[model samples]
Target: QKEVEQDPGPLSVPEGAIVSLNCTYSNSAFQYFMWYRQYSRKGPELLMYTYSSGNKEDGRFTAQVDKSSKYISLFIRDSQPSDSATYLCAILDYGGATNKLIFGTGTLLAVQP
Candidate 1:
């Protein structure tokens, strides 16, 4: 199994729609879960990071992690056209430094005006 997998969605939504993206991982040793947002060809910006199982909220974005199922989710509320971008889920190995991030194939989100 791949260490991490995502749908790579070209998910489209009207302005103000709620967006949910998810990923699953096979590595039980992953302890740090993160969500990143990237615009066009730019590098991803860290959106949220959580340790183990729990929920972390920031502005319009919320990240949830379920360690037992090896799943993670990112939810965007009140989405806007400016929110259109690729969202990537990442996990850090238990042995690595905080800087090491293993990413999933990103989900593309398009918020239409």
Candidate 2:
């Protein structure tokens, strides 16, 4: 099994709705959890990163991590069409130059106006 698991969802929603994306992991050594948003035909941009357990919020985006449950989530409030994109969850493995990231399959989301 992969270290991280997330549904590859092409989730559709209306504008102004709340959107939720989730991932689960099997690795307990993962210390940094991150969420990235990618627009079509473009590179992914880091949206949020949290260490261990806690919630981080920025405007309409919120990222939550629960190490105890090996679960992580990203919540988008007042979703907009501009928010439509592919969301990826990743776990950071530290090893200096050898450091690597394990990513989920990525969830596609669309918000219609």
Q: Rate the local accuracy (lDDT) of all candidates.
A: 0.91, 0.95
Error of 2 at 100 (Å): 1.1
Q: Provide C-alpha RMSD values for all models, in order.
A: 1.6, 1.0
lDDT of 1 at 34: 90
Model 1, total clashes: 0
Superposed on all Cα atoms, model 2 deviates from the true structure by an RMSD in Å of 1.0
Best-matching candidate per lDDT: 2
> What is the Cα-based TM-score of model 2?
0.96
The clash numbers for all candidates, in the given order, read 0, 0
| Runs off by more than 4 Å, candidate 1 | 96-99
lDDT of 2 by residue, 1-113 (tens): 89999999889999999999999999897899999999999998999999989999999999999999999999999999999999999999886675888899999999999
lDDT of 1 at 61: 87
TM-scores, all candidates, are: 0.93, 0.96
lDDT of 1 at 67: 90
